[model samples]
Every structure is written in C-alpha cells, then in structure tokens.
Target: MLVFVTGGVRSGKSDFAERRAISLLKENGSNLHYIATNQVYDKEMQERVKRHQQTREKSGANWIVWEQPRKIDELFSHFKKDDVLLLDCVTTLVSNELFSGWETNSEKWKNVVFQFEIEQNLKCLFSQLAGAPWHVVIVSNEVSYDGFASDEGTKVYKRLLGRLHQHIVLLAKEAIMVECGLPCWKKGGIRT
Candidate 1:
C-alpha cells in the first residue's frame, strides 16, 4: 500500500504521517522504518535533523531509521513485506538532487529540459511502487498553495515539485493532503 501525504512546510504533515504509520505498525509489531530524506547541509538543518531524530526516538526505539538523501530505489531494497516504510519528505530529495548537479545547467536551455527529466524521474519512482513488498507512506510538501515565487530557481523548484506530486498522486494507492493536522484523502478508502 502507498500513502502519499502532502502539505505545506511546517503544516504537521510529517507528524501526521509518522503517527499514522506508527499506529499501524503497533498493531502489526515493531517493524516501522523511517526513511529520512533531509540532508544536514548547514547548522540549522543539522538542528532540524536532531529534533526529528529525537521525535522518532521518543516514539519507539524499535523503529528502524535510514537516512538516504539520494538513490531511493536502492534504499527500498532493504525493506521487507512486514515493514512499514515511511518517507519523511520528497521536496528535500529534489533539492538534494538539484544541488548535486544531477540536473545540468546549460546556458542555452530554459530549464525546461531539466524539469522534464526530474518529472520523469519521479514517474519512474512511483512506477516502482507498484506491487511493492512493504507498506509505503510518503510525505511531501505542497508548495503550490503559496503564490508564485519570484526568482528563477524558486519558480523551477515549485514547478518540478508540483509535477512530482501530480505524478505520485496518479500511482498512489492512497493520496492525502494534510492541513491543520487533518488529512483529506483524495484517493483510496484509507480511514485516517
């Protein structure tokens, strides 16, 4: 099963998803796994990472935590059918890939090519979720709610994120938009 939870930054989306996944895991045993995507690139990010770690630790020490900034396909291979795989957020994954220069910057291209490629990458990722061995809970940021960003990079980031979320929504067994600590399920009949 794939549950895609999306909301604005600091909208309690991650907390909501984590609690949902953990609740399910409690019934099935302590086989919950958190796949963190945030890369601690600066002091603020490091602190944020520590806080998230503390949250998970307080929840349960039985939960398996894996921090992978890139190569999600490789990461999923470690999961089992009984485990719950919770992805903290996909927005950070995009930023990580972008800053890592996986998307080339050509003076000639209008950034459209890179955007399309990223969308394709996301498509491939969701496609891989079909008949997955584990219960997957994906968390993402909903950036489209905010008005258009001014800078070129911000615009491109927003565009790619929207596209990525759209692609995942199509393949997701359960698609939800979190707001004010509440979830609106757009697909499937998951009662959350």
Candidate 2:
C-alpha cells in the first residue's frame, strides 16, 4: 500500500504515519525501514535532524534506518516484499534538487531543469510503489496554504511542490492532510 501523509510544519504528520506503519508491521511481523531524506546542513537543520534521530531511536529497534537525502530509487535493491518503508519526505529531496541545479534546463517544463528532475523523481518513486509489494509511507509538508512566496525562486518552488503534491496524491492509496493533530482525508478510502 502507498500512503502519503502530509501537513503543515509541526502538524504531527510524521508521528501519525510512523504509528500507522508500526501497527502494520506488528500485525504482519514485517521489518520497518525508514528512508530519511533530510540532511543536517546547518546548525538549525543539524538540531532538527538530531531531534528526529533521537525520536526514531527511542521509537524502537525493529527499524533499519537509511539516510538517503537523494537518489531514493537506489534503495529498491535492498528492500523486500514484506518490508515497510517510510520515506520521511519529498520536500527535502525537491529542495536538494533545486539548489543543486538539476532543474536548470529540462524539456519537461519551461521552468528550471531541477523542477522537472524533482517531479520526475517523485513520479518514478510513486510509480515504483504502485508495483512494489512492500508497504510505502511518504511524509511531506502541505505547502498549499502557506501564502504566496515573496520572491521568484520561492514562487517557482511553491509551484513545483504543489504540482508534486497533486501528482503523488493521485497515486496514493490513502492521502491525508493533517492539522492540529487531526487528519482529513483528501482522497482514497482509509485502510480497514
């Protein structure tokens, strides 16, 4: 099953997805693999990464963590049909691609090449999940209502992210938008 969990910053989306994944694994006696997509590039990010790592460590030892800030498709070689893989986000990966200039000159979109790169990467990832046997949970920020970004770069980033959300939500078996610890289903039925 492919589950996409999304919310504004600090809206408990990750917690909710992690709990759901744990329940699924416990019921099926399967392994949990956390594919972390964030990198500690600065003090703030470092602290945030540390805090998240601590939380994961306390959560339990049944999980095997893989820190893949980019190139997530590479991990498919190691995953099994019975495993549960939770990818902590599409946002970070997109940001990385943008800053790294992967979208500067692509034919898919008139915008930056990284824009197409990010979208293509996400589409490929979700497409793989559509055919994979393992359960996949994806966590991402709900940037829709964050207000218009002030600069050109910000505006472009928002456009790409919004498009990415739409693309993934279409492929998601279950799509949720969370707020204040509550989840509102955007599409698909909840798993029984």
Give the whole-model CA lDDT for all candidates, comma-separated.
0.77, 0.80
Q: Using alpha carbons, what is the TM-score of model 2?
A: 0.86
Error of 1 at 56 (Å): 1.0
- TM-score for each candidate, following the candidate numbering: 0.85, 0.86
- Which ranges of candidate 2 are over 4 A from the true structure? 101-114, 189-192
Which candidate leads the pack in lDDT? 2
Full-model lDDT, candidate 2: 0.80
Expressed as tens digits, the lDDT of each residue in 1-192 for candidate 2 is: 888899999998988888767876876637899999887768998887787777778878477889998888889989887788888888887776665644465333335665776677778877887678888888999776788788777677788888887877877888988888887887775532
**Displacement of the residue 192 alpha carbon in candidate 1, Å:** 9.1
Please, what are the lDDT tens digits per residue for candidate 1 over residues 111-139? 57766776687678767864576677899
- Roughly what TM-score does model 1 have, to 2 decimal places? 0.85
